[model samples]
Target: MKYTKDHEWLRVEGDLVVVGITEHAATALGDVVFVELPEVETMVAEGDEICVIESVKAASDILAPVDGEIVEINDKLVDNPGLVNTDPTGAAWFFKLRLDDLAVLDAFMDEDEYADMIG
Candidate 1:
């Protein structure tokens, strides 16, 4: 898994990259109450706001970490936004993206680097 400075985690599964906020981000957001996910098959550029998450504290947007097509989204989050807090790095994944080259992930931070940045 690779991490972004924005606190998003990217995990490669087969040829797709799964995207989610880190536990740190989830905690900062307080308890999540609603989620607005992007539609599958939508094309997005890096830095685009792809999803909206509303918590007890505030509403936050999940940005696309790379250029790709959104191939899938986790519908579970819509029904249970608290999943973002309880299972952020696992079942709370926001979406799966199919990028032109998975190699682009090399530019992101490793887990150790991410931990250090958070600290």
Candidate 2:
């Protein structure tokens, strides 16, 4: 898994890449009330806003960390957005990407570097 300074995370699983905000971001968002994800098969560039996560405190854009096609999304979030708060990095992952280039992940920081930056 890799993390971006914008708080998005990516995980390469075989041919698919999982994407979500960090636990730190979920905690800061308070309670997530809704989610808006792009349709499957949509093409997105790195840093493009592909979804919106609305929380009690604020609404935030969920960015595409790498150029890719959106293959799937966490439909569960539409019905139960709190999953974002409880499991931002696990069951609550926002979407999966068929990454354009796996090497793009290398541009991100590791967990230790991200933690230090936020602290």
Candidate 3:
């Protein structure tokens, strides 16, 4: 798994990359109330706003971490937003991205580096 400065985590699964906010991010947001996910099969570039998350604290956008097509999303989040708080790194993953080059992931931080940055 790789982590971003923005507190997003990426896990490579088969040929796709799964994306989700870290536990740190989930804690910061308080209790999530709603999640707006992107459409499957939508193409996006790095930094594009792809989803919206509303919590007790505030509403936030989930950005595309890399250039890719969104092949799948966790529809369960819409019905149970608290899943983000309960299982952020697992079932809370927002989407799966099919990238042109998975090699681009090397630019992100490792778990140790992400821990150090947050500290």
Check candidate 2 and list the clashing pairs. none
Q: Mark the 10 consecutive residues where model 2 has the least summed lDDT.
A: 99-108
Off by over 4 Å in 2: none
lDDT scores in order: 0.98, 0.90, 0.97
Q: Distance from true position, residue 28, model 2, in Å?
A: 0.8
Regions more than 4 Å wrong, model 3: none
Sort every candidate by lDDT, greatest first.
1, 3, 2
Q: Residues 17-103, candidate 1, lDDT per residue (tens digit)?
A: 999999999999999999999999999999999999999989999999999999999999999999999999999999999999999
Q: 44-98 in candidate 2: lDDT tens per residue?
A: 9977989999999889998888888999988999999999999899999989999
- Provide the TM-score for each candidate, comma-separated: 0.99, 0.96, 0.99
lDDT of 3 at 30: 96
Model 2, residue 97: C-alpha shift (Å): 0.5
**Which residue pairs does candidate 1 place in steric collision?**
none
Q: Which predicted model would earn the best lDDT?
A: 1
Select the stronger candidate by lDDT from 1 and 2. Answer: 1
Cα shift from native, residue 73, model 1 (Å)? 0.5
